[model samples]
Target chain A: EDQVTQSPEALRLQEGESSSLNCSYTVSGLRGLFWYRQDPGKGPEFLFTLYSAGEEKEKERLKATLTKKESFLHITAPKPEDSATYLCAVQVGGGKLIFGQGTELSVKP
Target chain B: DTAVSQTPKYLVTQMGNDKSIKCEQNLGHDTMYWYKQDSKKFLKIMFSYNNKELIINETVPNRFSPKSPDKAHLNLHINSLELGDSAVYFCASSQQRQKGEKLFFGSGTQLSVL
Candidate 1:
């Protein structure tokens, strides 16, 4: 079974704190890895898309990197508005997306 | 302008009631999808339709049915709603299956079953 697991289910970080969230996956065939930020009561907002191993993408204070079996979402000097659940998902065959449980991040000022 | 949108931002109903949540995309995309996020915040794809063709159905219960009237519209109808069905439902769309474009998601609809 293709599985995606996100570690540190929840984290509390002070403003300006930098940390990384881990997502490990095992799939039959990996096509793409995606990162999304979701606020309370809202759907996920697309962040970055990594296609192959050693691929990396960045947006503001967020950077996403993918490896052969894992992906990392690195947050740098996160602001309070950046407090949201970060979701990691992968695409297998036929565009089927398998998502991880998500890492809830809280940034306090 | 919203690229993707879902109707009824919040729904509260009793068990056994049937309800329909509608979704529409204005991105000129050819594929639409429905995803369910449970209380634990696990997002899972329930159905995917491409140009009105059923492409992916993830072993969801028969009570959960997705209908795509066209390339831009996809509706999910749940029969005999149960408490466990209460969750945040999201509607998303992409450019195409072969391209595997990134999805544009709606704000979401919260369903509460009593």
Candidate 2:
């Protein structure tokens, strides 16, 4: 069975603090790993996609790195605006995405 | 312009009533999907349509039906709504049903059943 698990269900970080969220996945064949940020009362926004192990992508203060069995979303000196629920999803050979339970990040100013 | 759009951003109704949520994507994608996010924030896929054809249908109940009149539009109609059916429904589209295609999602519709 394909499954995605995100750890640190909730995290509270002071402004300018750096932390990392983890996503561990088990799939039949790894096709893609996606990261999304969802705000309250809004839909999810795409953040990054990593296709292979050792791949990494970055945007501003956010960086995502992938491994064979897991992915990490690293927030560098995050601001209050960076607070949101970060979701991790993995796509297998069938093109369907299996999503994790998301990590709620609260960056206090 | 919105890449993907869903109508009735919020819906409130009583149990056993019927309702529909419409979704349209203007990105010219050939594949569209419906996902439900429960109160626990667990997002799950309900259905997927590729070029107006059903490609993937999860174990969702039969009361929920998805219609894709065209490649750019996918609508969801739920019959006999129940309190347990209340959740946020999101519409998304992808260029194709490929292994790594990025999906564009619309603002979700929050459905509340009394």
Candidate 3:
């Protein structure tokens, strides 16, 4: 069975703090790995998609890096507005995406 | 414009009542999906439709049916809603079956069954 596990279920950070959220998965075959940001009462917003190991993508203060067995989302100098639940999902050999429970991030100003 | 949208942001109904949540995507994508997020924050895929064809159906009960009238619209209909059915449902869309394209999601619909 395909499974995704995210570390540090929740994190509280001071404004301007940099942190990293971990997402490790075991899939039959990884087509792609995805990262999304979801706020309370809202749907997840697409962030990045990494296809191969050693690939990295960045947007604003967020960076996603992928490896053979896991992926990491790094937030640099995050602001209060960046506080939200960060979700990591992986597309198995099939076209369906299996998601992690997510890491709740709170940025205190 | 909203890339993906689900109608009735909140739905509250009694058990045994039937209800429907509608979803549409204006992104011109051919693939659409429905996901359920439990109160504990576990998100799971319930169904997916690609170009109006049923693609992935995850062990969802037959009482819960998904209707895709067109490629742009995929609506979920629940018959005899139960307390266990209460959860936030999200609608998402992606382009072709190709890899590397991210899925765009709607605002979501929160369902409460009492």
The TM-score between candidate 3 and the true structure equals 0.97
Deviation in Å, model 1, residue A99 alpha carbon: 0.5
Candidate 1 chain B weakest ten by summed lDDT? B96-105
Instruction: Answer with 1 or 3, whichever has the higher DockQ.
Output: 3
Local accuracy of candidate 3 as per-residue lDDT tens digits, A1-109: 8999998899999999999999999998899999999999889998999999999999999999999999999999999999999999999744788999999999999
Better of 1 and 2 by DockQ: 2
Number of backbone-clashing residue pairs for each candidate, in the order shown: 0, 0, 0
Q: CA shift at B106, candidate 3, in angstroms?
A: 0.7
lDDT order of candidates, top first: 2, 3, 1
User: DockQ, in order, for the candidates?
Assistant: 0.71, 0.75, 0.78
List, residue by residue over A10-92, the lDDT tens digit for candidate 1. Answer: 99999999999999999987878888889998889988888889988888999899899999999999999999999999888
Q: Best by lDDT, which number?
A: 2
Worst 10 residues of 3 chain A by lDDT: A90-99
- Please report, in order, the local distance difference test score of every candidate based on alpha carbons: 0.92, 0.94, 0.93
Model 3 C-alpha lDDT versus the unseen true structure: 0.93
| Candidate 1 segments whose C-alpha is farther than 4 A from its true place | none
* Worst ten in a row by lDDT for model 1 chain A: A89-98
Which number leads on DockQ? 3
